[model samples]
Target chain A: MDIKAYIILSLALFTIGIVGVLVRRNAIIIFMCVELMLNAVNLLLVAFSKMHAMSGVAKASPYFASDAQVFVFFIMVVAAAEVSVGLAIIVMMYRNVHTVDVNFLNRLKN
Target chain B: MNLTTLVFILLSVMAIGSAIMMISSKSPVHSVLWLIVVFFAISGHYILLNAQFLAIVNIIVYAGAIMVLFLFVVMLMNLNAETEPVKNYRLQLVGVITGGALLLVLVSAVMKIDVEQLVEMKVGDQGLIKVLGMNLFKNYVLPFEISSVLFLSAMIGAVVIGKKDETANQ
Candidate 1:
């Protein structure tokens, strides 16, 4: 696989995700965008791992060898946990406010 | 025009298109469905990278479990397109500009990297299951052990937060 192409596509996805989170008023859409961003980063990390693996230095450097995949694994775990907690919070917010609009979440404002 | 490049092109297009659709769709349920498609496309990319285990886990966890939870939440909330609030035009413009700027910067930086040097690296043949299993069990065992604790905490947290408050007047 062309690592650069993967990197570029992932970057594009990440950018779109950022925009989605920023522009969208719906909380569910924002959560989806956050997932998109996380997936994008995971894509880049895997590409880097493959690139490093191809370089043969992965075996020499203990950190580079298996750590990349391990790191991705940890990231996946964290992302999963985050979604559970985050969606719960969103559900709570919606139940209380009856709206998922981000702009109306200004009840904390003085 | 090689197999890798061809696969990359196909998966990238599918992933990006579904991602865009996930965000842009007016219906929340439609967005969740599109997100599932995006997750599958990403798993395809993982497979192309030769991480078969990761790809399978990716599908099972993200596409199957996580997205199903999202769909349930949307349905339980009774969300519909008409109820969704519309964002102001100025914020929309700013978002598009910001996203475009970030994409330009990232692409330019990536373009500056030396691809030939990266390609010179020798690829390993240890498939996903073998290499990751050995490494996770061997050198990075501590993190592997800690992850269980993390998962336990997350489960508890989810239960606590998701529990309904019956005493509080609705």
Candidate 2:
């Protein structure tokens, strides 16, 4: 497949994620939108890795294309850890405020 | 035209559709469920790109674990559609317009870049577990160990934050 097609698809998905983050007021939905953006980036990275693998330089190194996939792996790891901590914070916030609306989280302004 | 392109189009539609549904849904639980559908569609894309390791990991980690955590939290909070907070329609309109503007700028910039490359579809072994494992343990061993420490810290942080604050309660 043409790399441009993948790029466009990934860009569209990322745009949808950006829209989700901006339009939603729920903190959890916002977090999910962030995850969607991360996945879009991951998909593009893998596509680019394949593009690099098809290049002549990759003939010299068998592992040339593996770097991007490894980066995606670590991204997943960090995202998992981040979700744990973030959800914990969200839960604590709900306990205190009883709502997940981002608008109500303005205590810092005072 | 071919099967690969056809599958790619299908998966892209699935992902984008579910993501929109996730944001538009009123209930947090529904949003979480829709997000899982998006993850599965992305996993399908990973598989189409021949990144089998990432395909499996994305399903297991994102769809299975993290989404379940989100669902659990939503249920624990007893958040339903009726309890959902409403925002002014003008603010939502502004947000949608802003997001659309950002997309237009990014898409235009990306179109200007010269990309004559082809993505290797189901034809590469670089995405296999063996290659990834060798690279991870050989060249990237330090980052692997550091990631474990990061996980530990995150675990501790979650526990510390989630624990009932007796002092604050008193």
For all candidates in order, the CA lDDT equals 0.82, 0.89
Off by over 4 Å in 2: none
Candidate 2 lDDT by residue in tens digits, B2-104? 8888998899899888988988888889999999999999889888888999999999999999999999998999989998886788888998898888878
* Local lDDT at B75 for model 1: 94
lDDT string, candidate 1, A1-110, tens digits: 55777778889899989988988899989998999999899877877777777777637544454566677788889988888888888888887888889888887897
| Residue A11 displacement (Å), model 1 | 0.6
**CA displacement after TM-score superposition, residue A62 of candidate 2 (Å):** 2.3
Pairs that collide in candidate 1 are A54-B121, A54-B122, A55-B121
lDDT of 1 at B19: 85
Candidate 1 per-residue lDDT over residues B37-127, each given as its tens digit: 9889988877777777778888989988999999999999998899878798998899989899989988999899887534212235433
**lDDT: worst 10-residue window of model 1 chain B:** B118-127
Q: lDDT by residue for model 2 over A2-110, one digit each (tens)?
A: 8888888888888888888888888888898898899999999999999888775747776888899999999999999999999999999998988899999987998
- Fraction of the real A/B interface contacts present in each candidate? 0.57, 0.81
